[model samples]
Target: MSPEFYTISQVADILSVSKETLRRWDNNGTLIPERDDGNNYRLYHKSQLEQFEQAQLLFQSNWNDELNIKASRPYKMLELFAGAGGLALGMEKAGLESVLLNELDKHACNTLRENRPDWNVVEGDISNIDFSEYHNEIDVLTGGFPCQAFSYAGKKLGFEDTRGTLFFEFARAVKETNPKVFLAENVRGLLNHEDGRTLETICDVIDDLGYKLVNPRVLKAIFYQVPQKRERLFLVGIRKDLISNSEFDWPSPYHRIMTMKDALKAGELYDCDVPNSEGQKYPKRKAEILAKVPQGGYWRDLPDDLQREYMMKSYFLGGGKTGMARRLSWDEPSLTLTCSPAQKQTERCHPEETRPLTVREYARIQTFPDNWKFSGPISAQYKQIGNAVPVNLAFAVGRSIIKTLNIIEKNTAMNKKKCA
Candidate 1:
């Protein structure tokens, strides 16, 4: 039978709150949990959760049905900053064909080329390349360009003003290719970057280029089959002429939040147990200290002296340095992966092991296929995986975009028949 009572971790997933927040609620007598007789673990009865609207939504979700999405026809796409093909691979799984991809990193390019030999991988700086040849031939243009501010200088934003930034190169590609649609992916901080001037200028530039900007959304990867708490901001735009016929919809969330158990084990997400691979090991003293941390525990879980010894000056600093000496919990999603697993500020220790996550483990957490290999040193591989969009998250977005494009295709065909 499915679960009637949920653990604190499971409830956190449904309610979208941290365990610490839930604990606070417990302390305040907001919602008390019934203790499990077997192990004295806290378990919230299902009846206690109906008060939360988010919990109710999970009860009535239709994620399995949403997976029926498919393309009506082959839609061509072009990409910039295509690192390790994460977004492109996900889009392909959703039925979009990549005509070309541009990247400055030779390693990421090699990884792409090695995986998909037929893909047209162009390795170079975006500004040095020309996208004019693909004009009108491409259906969509996508880029995860770096977030950089364009100086406002008390003037209205325009295409010419974005010249010095990578976003400008992305805009230049959109202007050159005139794709039916385009997407610019960035960190969620972009929404508030420069006190929101950056996004405002981006909107103004989209207007100048003859596209209608959909309200951008910062999509949480965990909601879209990724077993990590990563968020990426996606800005979807449609050409002005097709705006009337286009009906874009964001992908529906899965019924349940995926956890680390689902990711690393041979469960619903994968067919086999995670393969043994090379990973970074902690020094003897560091490993001994980290081993004291229980699953889901961080520096605060340590003894006072160990905490002081490990955190050093950081222990006295303000703000919850939760990521320090952290050990992931199997029952919860992994924290967002970073460029290197051993980074002190963003440590991602294994649940039961005292080592940094392996490269393959990092790839698995990012929702990359087990077979997909990175072509670089271990550190470089981590960098590529860390910077990638979660493949399943991209698949969800790609399917939604394809659904919109299918409507545009049918509407255009009907119009052509009427003209004939």
Candidate 2:
């Protein structure tokens, strides 16, 4: 059963807004939270949220009905930066077939091949690869290219101006393949990177390449049944000539938010408890100190003397370093997972244990399947999982993309019949 009152974070996850946005709304009296009598926590009632369109769709969603989505035909996908096959797995689950995948990391490549021996996993730098042979052959081209700044010369940036960046390689692939559709995934920070000029340049490049882009939308992973509060920005594009035949729709939210309990324990998300696995350990002193901090608590919850001891000279620093010494709660979604869980500024201690989250626990939080084994050393495994788009989140997006592709496919069939 879920709680009646919503925390600021829960509301943010449901409405897909930032906590700061909720605070701004509070100040403006658009939506206000009643203070809890026990702890003075700001709590929003469901009645306060009834006016929101996002809230309405979430509460009234037919998620089970939507799960029946199936591709009209076998849609072939070619992907770049295919780390640990997270997106590929999701695409497969959504009934898409993979013809090729390229990645620079040998460990991630090994992981992919280990799990899917049939996939054509190309292990090398993407810049050296030629995509022209697959021109007009691929149904979709996808890449979660790293974000890098393009030098501005005081003029509107063009496609060539983005040279020397990984994004350029992605654009090069799109130019060569000429797929019906393409998806470019990036971190949410890309929206405001370099005063938003970076994304502006990307948009301009897509337009120059003769593709009509859907307005980029940032999808919150938690909204799509991922039990962690991870967010990814997705840019979907249609080859301009094909844009009129089909419409692209973003995936809908699940009926309810999933909690950490749903992730690690046996329940709706998984059929069994997370198996034991290797994880980072805290120093003796750190472990003792962390034991005192309750679940869901952070550095500020420690005793004052211990706080000074733990924080050292940094104790007097301004602003809430809320993530430090943080412990997760079973009842709420996790903070975003990173490449390392034991990092001092972003501790991800287990709910019932004092140590950092195990590699498998990290995988579970990312919605990777229980049987989907990760290859490489422990650190490499963590890196692969951390950098991945959640498998379930990717599946949701893949289904929506398939919906548009089915329409385009039917139109093409009709056109061919007329020509015959």
Candidate 3:
């Protein structure tokens, strides 16, 4: 069965509200929590949370229903930076055909080839590839290009001004392919990068390349059925000619919040418990110190002496530093997975066990299916999975893109008949 109670911190994270706000609500009698007898800690009941609009989505019977949005006709896609096939797999699940997938990492390309032997996985530098062959043929072009700062060499940044950056390559592909729509994903920090000029420049470049940019949005993965609290910024652009005919909408959030329980157990997300896989281990001293941390607790929960011993001079520094020495709670979504689970600064120790989460567990948290095999050494495997867009989240976005295309296709068919 699912959890019946949640701590204040858990509730705050789930509702995307600050702890201070939760306390204010409690004081105002807007949303009160029950007090624990042992320590008098505030605990919120699942039933009480249902009173909230965000929480109410979880209780609706149709919350997890698949939109099953399908392509009205044959639609092909060309994917760039196809890391470990996370986005490609999700788009494939959404019924889009993968015409080509390009990646620089050999391990990722191998993983893609091993999993989907039929896919045309191009393994090389993206700068060397010619995308013009697919021009006006492919339906969509998608990628998560790495963000790089643009040189302030010009007053008004245009397509040519962004020539050296990875985003430029993404834009160049969009220009060459001239797909009906293109999607780009990046870290949430991109929204405010370089005081927002970076994003403004990107928008200007998209316009220069003959596309209409949609209002970019930062989507929370937890809201879309993934069990991690990851946020990604998405930019969708349509061809100038098709912009007037297409209507795009963001995907709806899942009905209920999924916890670590759902990711690891045979619940809604997976049919079986998380499979055992290789993972990094804590050193003897580190393991001994972390064992004292309770579920949902972090470095602050340690005794004063141990805190100093573990943290050293850094403990004296300011900032919450909550990710340090942290243990995840079973009833709440896991903190965003990092490239290294056992990193000293961002530890993701198991809720009950003292060790770090294994590879399969990490994949499960990212909503990668159990059968999806990642190729490479342990470190490379972690890097690939950690760097991936959550599959379910991508699937949700892909469905929205498909919906827009469906509308555009219908309108085009009607116009062709009228012209005839």
Window of ten residues with lowest summed lDDT in model 3: 57-66
Model 2 spans with C-alpha error above 4 angstroms:
1-9, 16-45, 418-420
Best by TM-score: 1
The lDDT per prediction is: 0.90, 0.91, 0.91
- Cα RMSD of all models vs. native, in order, equals 1.6, 2.5, 2.4
Taking the candidates one at a time, how many backbone clashes does each contain? 0, 0, 3
Candidate 3 residue pairs that clash: 57-255, 58-255, 58-256
Rate residue 113 of model 3 by lDDT. 95
Ten contiguous residues with the weakest lDDT in model 2 = 1-10
- The regions of model 3 sitting more than 4 angstroms off are 1-10, 28-30, 34-66
Cα deviation of 294 in candidate 3 (Å)? 0.3
Candidates in order, TM-scores: namely 0.96, 0.93, 0.94
lDDT of 3 by residue, 1-420 (tens): 236887887688668898889999999999999998889989999999887776765556343454767889878999999999889988888879999999999999999999999999999999899999998899999999998899986598989889889999999999899999999999999999999999999999999899998999998898889989999999999999997788998887876678899999998899999998999999999999999999989999999999999999889999989999999989788999999999989999999999999999999999999999999999999999999999999998988889899999999888899999
